[model samples]
Target: AQQQENSEKVAKAQGEQFQSLTQIASGQADIAKLQNQYSSYNIRNGMYTIVAAQSGQVVKAQKAGIGEFVKEGDMIAEIVPDDVKYAVEMFVRPLDLPLLANGQKVRFMFDGFPAIVFSGWPDVSSGTFGGEIVAIESNVSVNGKFRVLVQEDKDDRRWPRQLKIGAGAQGISLLKDVPMWYELWRNVNGFPPDYYQPASGQKNSKTSK
Candidate 1:
C-alpha cells in the first residue's frame, strides 16, 4: 500500500510538470503576437508623399484653397515635367507631313532667345530615341496644321498651353531640343549656316533704309 501511494505521488508531480511547460509555450506565443502588433504601430507612424516628381512651374489645382478637403487620388496641384530636354513641336500640313520621317533633321531657332541655332534631338544615353508622328483631327483648326509630334526622349506628356509655348510654333519648322552631339555636328558642318542671328534685341532698326 505504501508503494502504491508513492506511485500516485510520482504521477501527480509529472502532471504538474506538463502543465508548467504548456503555460510557458502559451506565454511565448502571446509575446510573438504582441511583437507583431508593435511593428504595425511603427508603420502607421511613418507615412508621407512627395509634392511633385519633377520641379518646374507649379500651379495650385482649381479645387486647392486654404483648408480645402481633397478626396483620395485627387490632384492637389500641377507640375510641368520640364526636366527632360525641351522639344519644340509644330504641326505640319498633310503635304508637309510626308516630308517628315523618323530621322529627317531640321533647324530650329527661338523667337525670344535665338542665340543657338538648335537642331535635332538632344544626345540621349540611349541611342537617339525615335520621333513620333501623331495624327489629330483634320477640321479642328481653320488653318490646317496637322499634329506632327516629334520628341528626342519619350517622356513627353501633354501639359497646359502656356507651358508649351516655344514648342508649339506652327508651319513646317519644328524647333526641337536635340542631342548635344547633333547640334555640334551641325555646327561643324555648314548645315544651319550663318542665317541665325542672336535674338538679344540688339539689332539697329534705324540703320535699315
Candidate 2:
C-alpha cells in the first residue's frame, strides 16, 4: 500500500507539471501572435509612418512641423487629387437667385486670365470660357449671399489646362429666353428675372385670392 501511494503521488506531480508546461506554451504562442500583429505597423527608425488613405496632392498640411505632437484622428493634411475634376464656386446675391437655374450657361472670366471676357449671349468663343450651373444652395450665407457651383459646360472645353484651385473668378449665368421688353421692365423695376414657375397644382399664396 505504501508503494502504491507513492506511485500515485508521482503520477499526480507529473500531470501537474505537464499542465504547467502546456500553459507556458500557450502564453508564448499568444505573445508571438501579438508581436506579429504589432510588426505589421510600419515603424522605421523609431518613427511610425502615417499613410494617407488616398493618394493625392497635399494642398494643406496641419501640424506638419517636426516634433509636433498629433493625437489619433487629428487632421494632418488636406489633399486635392490631381485627377479630380473641379468646379467654380461663386457667391451670388440673394436677389439674383431667382434668375439662376441648373443647366443654365455661365460665362466665366478667371481673374488669372483678365484678357478674356465671357458672355452668356451670342454663343461666341473668345478668351473667355463657358460653364454650366450645376448647383445652387437654398440657404443664404451669413453675409446674405447664396453659393453657386458652375461646372465646365459640355462641348465648351476652353478652360485653361493649368488653372489654379481657388482662383478667383467672376461668372454670369444666362437666364431663360424672354422678350426684350420683359427684361427691360424687370431691370427698370429692380425685379429679379423669374426662372421658376409655380406647379400646376400649386398656387402662389400671395397672388391667390
Candidate 3:
C-alpha cells in the first residue's frame, strides 16, 4: 500500500509541473501578441499626413486655403500623376459627334504652342499629336454633350506628361462651360454646313431673268 501511495504522489506532481509550464508559455505568447499590436498602432499613426503621390501641376481645386471646412471625401485637389500622357477635352456638338469614332485621326492645336503641326523638333511646340478618339461620353442633353476624357501619348517629353491644375500652379485657365456656350452660340448663328449660302453663278443669272 505504501508503494502504491508513492506512485500516486509522483503522478500528481508530474501533472502539476506540466500545468505550470503551460501557464508560463501561454503568458509569454499573450505578451508577444500585445507588443506586436502596439507596434502596428504606432506605424499607422505615423502615416496620418496626406501627401501627393507624384509631382505634377494641380488641374482642379475643389476646396483649399486655411480655415476652410472640408467634409469627408471632399476633393482638395487633382494631381496629374507623373509621366502620364494628357489630352485636351473639346466637346463636339451631338450632330458632329456622329462623324467622330474610335481610331479616327485627330489634329490637336494648343493655345500655348502656335505651330499648327509638330515638326519633330526637340523643343516644345504647339501641334497635333498622333491620336485617336479612344472614348465618347454619351450623356447628351439640352446642355450639349457631356464630358469626354481623352488620353494623349507622352512621347513628347517636353513637360511632365501629366499636369495637375490647382496644385503649385494655377487651376484650369478657363471654365469648361465657356466652350459649351460657344458651341451653342455658333449653332444659333447657323455655323458650318448649317449656314445658308446664297447660290452663285448660273443660278443668280437665272434669277435675274
Candidate 4:
C-alpha cells in the first residue's frame, strides 16, 4: 500500500511538471504574437508619417496641405540634395536624331549664363559647360522631338549651384568633323544642318557635322 501511495505521488508530480511546461510554452507563444503585433504597429505608424529616405532639402512640399487625404504612390514632395548633380535635357528633330548617340560629348550654354561657343570644338569655347549624352528616348516626346538626357562630365568643371530646376539650356552636339566651308554650303543651299530654331522657343538643340 505504501509503495502504491508513493507511485500515485510520483504520477501527480509528473502531471504538475507537464502542466508547468505547457503553461511556459503557451506563454512563449503569446509573447511571440505580441512582439509581432508591436512590429506591425511600428510599420503602420511609419506609413502615416512623411519621412525622407535620404538627407536632402525639401524643395517642394505636399500640394494638398496638411491633414489631406492622399493615396499610396502619390508624389508628396521633391527633395534636392546639398551637392546635386543636375541633368540637362534637350530635344532633337527626326533628321538630327541619326547624328546623336550615347557617350557623345556635348557643349552646353545655360540660359542664365553667357557663352561664346565655337560649336564643334569645346576646348576653345569659353563659359561653356561640358556634358555627355546619357539617354535617348526610344519614343518621341510630347513636343514631337526625340528627347535626350545629358549629365555633367565628371572630368569637366562642375555646373553652377545657383542653377534652378527647369532652367533653359542650349546644347551643341558635334556629330562629325567636317569642313567649315561644307557646313556653310549646306546652310546656303537649303540643306538643313540638323536643327532649325522655331519662334515658339520649344526646341533649342543643334547638331553639327
Can you write out model 4's per-residue Cα lDDT over 1-209, one digit (the tens) per residue? 99999999999999999999999999999999999999999998997877777878888876656668777888888898776678998989988887777777877889879888675665777998888788899999899999999999888888888788789998876555568898889878987555322134366889999
Superior candidate under TM-score, 1 versus 2: 2
Please give the TM-score that candidate 1 achieves against the real structure: 0.45
Q: What is the TM-score of each candidate against the true structure?
A: 0.45, 0.68, 0.46, 0.61
**Inter-residue clash pairs, candidate 3:** 57-164, 58-164, 58-165, 58-166, 58-167, 59-164, 59-165, 59-166
The Cα error of candidate 2 at residue 134, in Å, is 1.4
Considering TM-score, which of the candidate structures 1 and 3 is the better prediction for this target?
3
C-alpha lDDT of residue 24 in model 2:
100
Give per-residue CA lDDT, model 2, range 121-201, as digits (tens): 535545677897789999998888999998888768668887879888877555567898988999999886665432346
Q: The CA-based lDDT of model 4 is what?
A: 0.82
lDDT of candidate 1 over 67-104, digit per residue (tens) = 56667887767766666544555656675454455534
Specify the poorest-scoring 10-residue window by lDDT in model 2. Answer: 116-125
Query: Between the candidate structures 1 and 4, which one is better when assessed by lDDT?
Result: 4
Which number leads on lDDT? Answer: 4
lDDT of 2 at 143: 80
* Residue-level lDDT for 27 in candidate 2: 100
Which sequence of candidate numbers ranks them by TM-score, best first? 2, 4, 3, 1
| 2 against 4, candidate with superior TM-score | 2
Model 1 regions lying over 4 Å from their true place:
49-85, 115-146, 151-209
